[model samples]
Structures are given as structure tokens and as C-alpha cells.
Target: MDIFEKVKEIVSEKLHISPERITLESNFKKDFEADSIDLFELVMTMEEAFDVELDDDAVVGIETVADVVHYLQEKM
Candidate 1:
């Protein structure tokens, strides 16, 4: 699967939401009501899934699904 698809899968599983509910513009906090711990787990899961180490600085700027896709795109 592509980055977004992979991300959607991870987010769906992590948040216990449907993949159809996720979009690039969906905000983790606003849309999913995800707290810091949720974000942290998502980050850690993404790291393992994508096989990349996400720095704190980079992760801080990630608010939407698009941000994660972009970051992974740039990193890969």
C-alpha cells in the first residue's frame, strides 16, 4: 500500500475508527479527539511500520494525516 493508505490503516487501527473517516485534512486532535498519548502511540507505530525514526521536531509539526504522509515521503 501507499503511504497514505498505510497511514490510514495505522490510524484506523490505533484510533479504532474506520478508514473511510480518515482523510489528508483530518486533524488528529480535532477529528479523532486524540490526546498526547494517542499521538505518541501513533508515532511509535508509524516509526515501526515505516521503519523510520521520527524526530521530536518533525513530529511536533504533524497535525494532519497529510503531514505524516509528507514527512514520510520526504524521509523516504
Candidate 2:
């Protein structure tokens, strides 16, 4: 799967949402209704899935799925 699709899987599993509800433009809080704890797990899951180290500053700017994909592409 592509980066975005992988990300959608991660988020969908964490948020317990259907995959169809996730979109590139979907916001974590607004669209997925993720709590702060959920975001924490999501970040860690993304880091592990991508096999990359994510800094606190990097996590701070990650507000959407597209943002995570773009950042992961850059890291790769």
C-alpha cells in the first residue's frame, strides 16, 4: 500500500473508525475524534510502522494524514 493508505490503516485501527471515513483532508481531532492518548499511540505506531525516529517537534506539526505521509516520504 501507499504511504497514505498505510497511515489510514494505522489511524483507522487506533480510532476504531471505518477506513472509508478516513481521507487525506481528515483531521485527527475533528474527523476521527481522537483523544490525546489516541494521538500518542498513533504517533508511536507511525514511528514503528515507518521504522523512523520522530522528534517531538516533528510530532507537533503532524496534524493530518497527509502531513504524516509527507513527513514519512521525506524521511524515507
> Which has the greatest lDDT?
1
Which digits, one per residue and each the tens of the lDDT, describe model 2 over residues 1-76?
9999999999999899999988888889888778789989999998899999888898888788888888899998
Listed per model in order, the count of residue pairs whose N, CA or C atoms clash below 3 Å is: 0, 0
Writing each residue's lDDT as its tens digit, candidate 1 over 1-76 gives 8999999999999999899999999999999999999999999999999999999999998999999999999888
TM-score of model number 2: 0.93
Candidate 1 local Cα displacement, residue 2, angstroms: 0.3
TM-score of each: 0.98, 0.93
Highest TM-score scorer: 1
Model 1 alpha-carbon miss at residue 68, Å: 0.3
- Local accuracy by lDDT, each model: 0.97, 0.88
Candidate 2 Cα misplacement greater than 4 A, ranges:
none
RMSD of 2: 0.9
